[model samples]
Target: MSAESLTPTETLVLLTLLAEARPVSNTELKTLGPELRAASRRKLTRLGLVATDTSVRPFTHELTDDGWARCRTLLGADTPPRVAPPVRAVYTLLRALGRHLDRADLQLYEVFAPATEEVAPVDDTSPTVEGRIRAAYRELAREPGAWVGLARLRSALADLPVDEVDRELVRMNRLPDVHLNPEMNQKALGDHDRAAAVVVGDTPNHLLSIEVA
Candidate 1:
């Protein structure tokens, strides 16, 4: 369904998720605005606009890629019918901001990055698979956004389980700052490289890029 078809609460939920750029629980959502009730959650999930992780208590929700695209559409859409005056005003500003972003060739994620928290260094402890992947990428990449072959990357994390590493890679790829790509120069791939590839969806990604913060 289009952004115009979303209910007011649904609209708020999507926008909040977009702004937060992190999974939010119902309790946390209450502080921002309306809490996401079960019925609304089911509708959003059914529409493939939101992803709810039930593994945790109070369940946390996050926007899917489709949800992000839906919010983008709203920037150009007319305000939904019967919205409060304040919300209408917000939309007016959003449309204007959207125009500015379009002219600047900027992505919404670039403007609404998730907040980073400072933590003590983890030099004494075993690093997470995701952390190891980032560390390996940093070592191999001459600069941020430089493509590092998965074969070489995997070699650095060889002690870690291949399946576990692949799962983390797929998850990391979903983030705006991380990218996984198949080598366009297919003729250059050796057997070792092919074996090291991680399959995301139907594509085998041989290269990794992580935007260093």
Candidate 2:
């Protein structure tokens, strides 16, 4: 569906997810602005604009890659029909920002990027290699338990020894909260993705996820 076809509530939901740039629960969505009830959630999922992980209690929602693209289109779009004045004002400003971004050649991800919460600080002898791995995962994943590509994870921990990182990943997978999964779409695997995979039980797992406390 085109951006123009989206209802005001749907548009708001997309905007909220874009602003968050992380997995948000339906409950939290209410507090943020839009209440993403069953109908809207299903519609977005069907349209490939959102991904909902229902495996966990209080299912979490995040924007898919297509969702991000759709949101970027909204930057240049006119405000949806029947929106209130405040929302129209938001779109007015968004259009202006979109023009500036276009002139500046900045992608939306560069502007609405997730903040790095944990990383290897310069102080030596503090965080262990395992600790560093966890930090890297947090920086990359949309939420806890979200599947993060191993290739991206390894890039974040580039300073560490490759063997050491792989060994720790194997050990961490045995934990209850940690999981390693193979990319089901094997055709999408590039050389780097294949090379970065950690083999577990003879399976080359290309994704890593750790449940947050």
Candidate 3:
């Protein structure tokens, strides 16, 4: 992968291989934890920065010769970057609403597509969709002190198709008291708007819980 495209863990894997200077067993790469190291190794392999030493029973991996050069380049970069914090879709909507924009809600809604973000899994034995949502909400959201993870909640109440949950969550966002994805990208509502906006995660803000007013 391009240096810029590497995820943190992937970068670490490259760096680790550079440091070890020899093939390391997958078990040994567990210095960064097995799950993450394995995942990073997979990505690194795809990018041609790492290769598996299949000569052994269990596979081991190490950086390629080019991988060493990539590491050197990353280490040599000395320029400081001028970058702004990423902007999130929900926060963008929040700012528009704060400004009382005529069609801000509609405009922002078009992007997040929370209505179709996820579809609940099917299970005929569970309660009705609405009933499940209500029950899950009550149990998990006596108050949104801690955000209930969307995926976790989805699994908790997976009887309905995920799209049904997404639709309800989108509708729920309309409530003044409820804040879907309230832990939004931080930014000033007025002024300080930037020339460009970038979304960081695939769906970092998707998981949500309600908050008390």
Candidate number that wins on lDDT, 1 or 2:
1
- Model 1 Cα shift for residue 68 (angstroms): 1.6
Q: Provide C-alpha RMSD values for all models, in order.
A: 5.4, 11.4, 17.0
lDDT of 1 by residue, 4-39 (tens): 377878888888998887788988888977789888
Candidate 2's TM-score: 0.56
For all predicted structures, in order, the TM-scores are 0.66, 0.56, 0.33
Model 2, residue 132: what's the lDDT?
Answer: 84
Error of 3 at 76 (Å): 2.5
**Runs in model 2 with CA error above 4 Å?**
1-4, 120-213
lDDT of 3 by residue, 84-146 (tens): 223233234334443542344322222322223333343445656544654676577656545
Candidate topping TM-score: 1
lDDT of 3: 0.50
- Residue 156 deviation, candidate 2, in Å? 14
Error of 3 at 180 (Å): 60
Query: Which scores greater on lDDT, model 1 or model 3?
Result: 1
**Model 1 ranges with Cα > 4 A deviation:** 1-4, 116-127, 144-213
lDDT by candidate, in order shown: 0.80, 0.79, 0.50
**Superior by TM-score: candidate 1 or candidate 3:** 1
